[model samples]
Target: MGLYDFTFYDLIHRNAVCYDGKPAWFEAETGATTDFSAFKTQVDCLAAGLQKAGIRSGDRIGVVGKNSLAFFTLYGAAAALGAIVVAVNWRLSENEVAFNLDDCTPKMVFADNEFGETITSLRDRLPSVDRFINLTDNGPLDAFDDLLDDAPFSGEPVSANDGLVIIHTAAVAGRPRGALLSHANLLCASLHLNHCFNLSPDDVHLNLLPLFHVAGLFMAVCAFHAGALNINMAKFDADKAVDLIAAHKASLLFDFSPILGSILDAGEKNGADISSLRAVMGLDTPETIERYRKTTGGCFYVMYGQTETSCLTTMGRYDDCPGSAGRAIPLGRVELVDDADNPVPPGQAGEITLQGPMVFKGYWNLDKDNDQTFRNGRHHTGDLGRFDEKGFLWYAGRKPEKELIKPGGENVYPAEVEKVILEHPAVSQTVVFGIPDPKWKEAIKAVCVCAPGQSVTAGELIEFVGQRIARYKKPQYVDFVESLPEKDGAIDREAVKQRYGGKQPGNS
Candidate 1:
């Protein structure tokens, strides 16, 4: 609450005055719109009601839902009261959802009506959760709309450095770790992104990504910070997205893998006019980027970032550097470091480290992890990359301990997948890795050796893993071999990848 401090609450208040009656957000499902002024009023009332419900500074509020007015309002209300919102990925399995909620120990849980049964079943396990508020109109629990009060918000002053949200990232070990993000982290990220995308009040943003993801939440916040209109979709429908763009003249959107591809296909097939799109940002294949650019005449921006960095650490137009991940953003310092914490020359690949305002607070409750990550005065991203002489970064994949695979932008660690594959009785040795794919940009592939007397089909093993974990984490391609290469008495993952890295199955 310093004199110069600026938080999301401050941004909302400023927009309410600056933008006034201008349309701020549009709900695609219901065709409802909320202007900036009305948005502020809703947030204030929600904040007052939440405070009355015993929510205080440092309190945790769990939210599991899609992109909706209620979801964004909860974010604003929590920020105003200095309460941290734990945004859970509703796409996860019931056990995974329960694990995240238990880890955060929220005071209240707000969820979409679709998850009423799931949350109700976990009520006994969540001792810290006092109330379960439903975000939708009809549900078994108390409705989120009922929590709104017209009374003025009266709570302790909030600081920009206070933790505002906790987003669980990919499991590096056995379970996902909640990454705590402060108000300053998100505000800085949004401001930087707004500048990068040249966003303005006249812009219309199509919110397609899930709010639980860093990219989704940051993009929405960036659009709001720019005083632009954000059209939110509870779930992505390619045809509906094209129609919305044509009808609303959306100027920007964030794409991952087949999203952009599907939009282009839908637009071409239906003769939909989507010429208004000016900037499209996210991870996608070169072919898709080229198609999007040629089809819509928009700039395809590339970036490299993690949840720990709040959002984009580096971003620039695709054509600017062609294949590189653009230059480091103005707000942050991106550097490459060797194993001993020394700087590496421009051309050599090394672990990526970040430092600046956009860096997140730290993992929610993992002190040892924070200590290791923040060592040497910079946040070790566990990702490897190299910078060219011109300063554009070329991503070189993740470190061994942090081996990751992003299928359609969702982080999936190889170790986590491998762990699940090993649980099958018919599997003796296995290695999981990522391979380039036309649709998902990257798809998980597993090479395994069957047990001596037990045999299992690829489909059976894939289904077994899917049932045990999130379906997205399941391998898209599986290949069985009699023996796998070994090094130092351990299964050599690198050897396995080198042999099976080809896009087609049974390549060896």
Candidate 2:
């Protein structure tokens, strides 16, 4: 560790002295609360135990679970020990989960009871995993608490620039790639957000998003850094969320699609008092933003960022620019560049690229991909956007090569889904794309061409795809077409989207 460096572990120690007995986090499932001083002690003990379990600096620790006290505790322990935490999305299929675990090849794999059986089934496939520890209490295995020890952490000092976490993004080339984030990346991002939100010890954050997601992980870190209380929910429940908000006077939260809408509905249905909520951040529809504003008089913050950027690159209140994604954040440089990597003039659409401390180190163990992504000294986001005269960023869409779909905020690449669809015997050609949906904000829609003399129903094809991949990646809407448009003997994906992307009768 450098003399001038300040890592996440340093922040935990600082908070222990500064905030001491103040509440740091609350687990909704267990109704357990841990204060800052005790939180630090727990993290230290966990770190000592993890070190004894053969975990060392630069080692990868796999975690697959929902938002919980145990999950965040592991994060703290990893940060202190300089071990990289490869947090896998629990919502993924067993195959998907195995792919992620094998990709990182963690020394120790920790999972909640829900995924205990799934991990056990894949034990043979994970060669590097020496131990599988359960994160919950009821699991029939070695519990995470068993790893706790009172011994002080005697590991080598960890540097701020050392890799801390690895979050795998949506598949771009038939498989997902892990983006490695360092301690400085996360600490810098948390500091930036702390300044942006004006967070303090009195603030209460309702953490509903899954811990495997960037938004969820970063927001929790930011709240913790600010000495704010984070109330964690294993999974989002609108009614339960409303009750928690009323009970805790939560000051802020991160939302995606129907979450904010459902919260409003639940608040009204229960006559719950949620007036304490001050700021809500993330992606949501304009109607829902307006409704939230009218109902609670709270600010709705919109942002544009990716997992590679440590969570956020730009953020601002929705009312500031009705349809814009806010302005560039202070800590990073956001530019709109053309294909040649030249800067585009204002009012023109171009790919969004970013650079700064907040930018991640690189994808884990993928040198060629890292080179291509970090070419020209900037991280190519593969997303397109434009800036207006007043400096507000207007998000256009994604580049063709990186076209993406988010059904309820989970990233789903059309190419991955298209591959699964084409596996069916009855499918000859298929095009998968995203379409606007009232509930999810964006829903996956598939336009398929069946093989000659072989027909398949939409339900049958959807089920076939679901069985092969994560259910969320399966098409929510399917349309059978006789044939797809072609250009130069190749399927024109743009043409297919333009012609059949909209909602159709009996498609859903």
Candidate 3:
């Protein structure tokens, strides 16, 4: 099938038949398993219940839940019914959740029972919602399980072009913005991923990432499309992950760099039977990939993509391409374009722009921001990167705040230096800012919040960064703040910048 011509549920149904008796999905905490036949039945029933509730193809349905089997089922059910599913981050404040629910105007909300307080606070605010269903409860308004008790559903399938999901992004840390992704986007992304990774039905996927984020949901979709077993973890615990790998004999785990680092740390301290672990890949810096591969004895892989790109624009094909975010997946047009919107020569740094079936329609309602981001036909990725001679894309840094300058024209990217500085035992959160310096235009300054009960002097931090990164990139000035102001427990860039670039402050 062509990349963009198939509906979202089609992939799951097809894969189910391909590997019917095999385990399709399982919750690590409960040992509950949903094989192909059961999965299909539940999806149909949920779709029927949703349709019975007056939801139609274009209707938006919001789902706010933790990583559970219900999330996967609801997501598919929404697709089957041709409705758009908005995956709201459970980590956000009640006010934020209320704001998003009001803004999105979903037909109904499937909320996690754990967030009942948030729901209680925002119930009045979400007037547009026709119903509030508890994802876990079996009684009352549209309980996830009861709705899915039917053996099968005859509901009509939505087209591939139908809006599939609206995923909210935690904007550099501000009011989150929703990105509208279509069924075509999701289907193409999974298909492209399956082909690129050469996934087989025998593979097993471990899902620890949050389902609210693209990585978490996309991992499930990829595994489903490939007819692979998907093991869903309620949360990321390194020790639990190791145990699950050994017990389930999991083949591949879609993880981030930090998770791998933690697992590697655990592996070094307490041994693990990773014999069944075929691959370990996630979003990480190129340098971290090398270090991780060396430490794990070449057992990990690296993937590179953005949330705007449906999370699978590029990947470093396991074992084939060692360090590069592999060549563009089929049906994607990835370009390294200069500031002038002209394509740059190979190996030259430029903004990465992608045109693909998987690219999101646009940022929800932020037309000005959308125009700024999605210029012409391509989605401008704000990331600075380049394509190498072998067609591998190399990520450099973000276009905005790309460089951290020091007193002597020294330039550093926070992503690169932060990776190294984050290794320090005393640091919990560290942000490097370019403080104004009259002598050199700008000087590198570090604002750090230390780990609980751990302390380090300014001189010690400066030396720590210097030993890891270039000496010039090390902060000339260090400010040990009590705690960084966070919007919702996540780093707030604007707040950080305001804190560093204080009022009435200029060039140093």
Identify the leading candidate in terms of lDDT. 1
TM-score, one value per model: 0.98, 0.98, 0.76
Q: What lDDT score goes with residue 95 in model 1?
A: 86
Candidates in order: C-alpha RMSD to true structure:
1.4, 1.3, 10.0
List the lowest-lDDT window of 10 residues for candidate 2. Answer: 499-508
Q: What would the per-residue lDDT of candidate 3 be over residues 1-508, giving only the tens digit for each residue?
A: 2354577787667766777777899899899998986788778788888877888877888878889888888888888877888888776556557777777899889877787666766777888888888888643445666555464565565677778888875433234578888888877777776765678888888888888778778878888888888999988898888788778877777765457666666666677765676676665444555655665444565556767899866776556676567778777788989888999999899998888777888878889879878788788877788888988877675676434332332224565556656889999988766665543445677788899999999899888877654466677777788888888878886688787754224432
Local accuracy of candidate 1 as per-residue lDDT tens digits, 436-472: 8878888899999999999999999999999878899
Residue 145 C-alpha lDDT in model 2: 78
Candidate 1: C-alpha lDDT: 0.92
Give the whole-model CA lDDT for all candidates, comma-separated: 0.92, 0.91, 0.74
Report the C-alpha displacement of residue 61, candidate 1, in angstroms. 0.7
Positional deviation of 30 in candidate 3, in angstroms? Answer: 0.9
Total clashing pairs in model 1: 0
Better of 2 and 3 by TM-score: 2
Judge candidate 2 at residue 387 and give its lDDT. 92
Q: Show the colliding residue pairs in model 1.
A: none
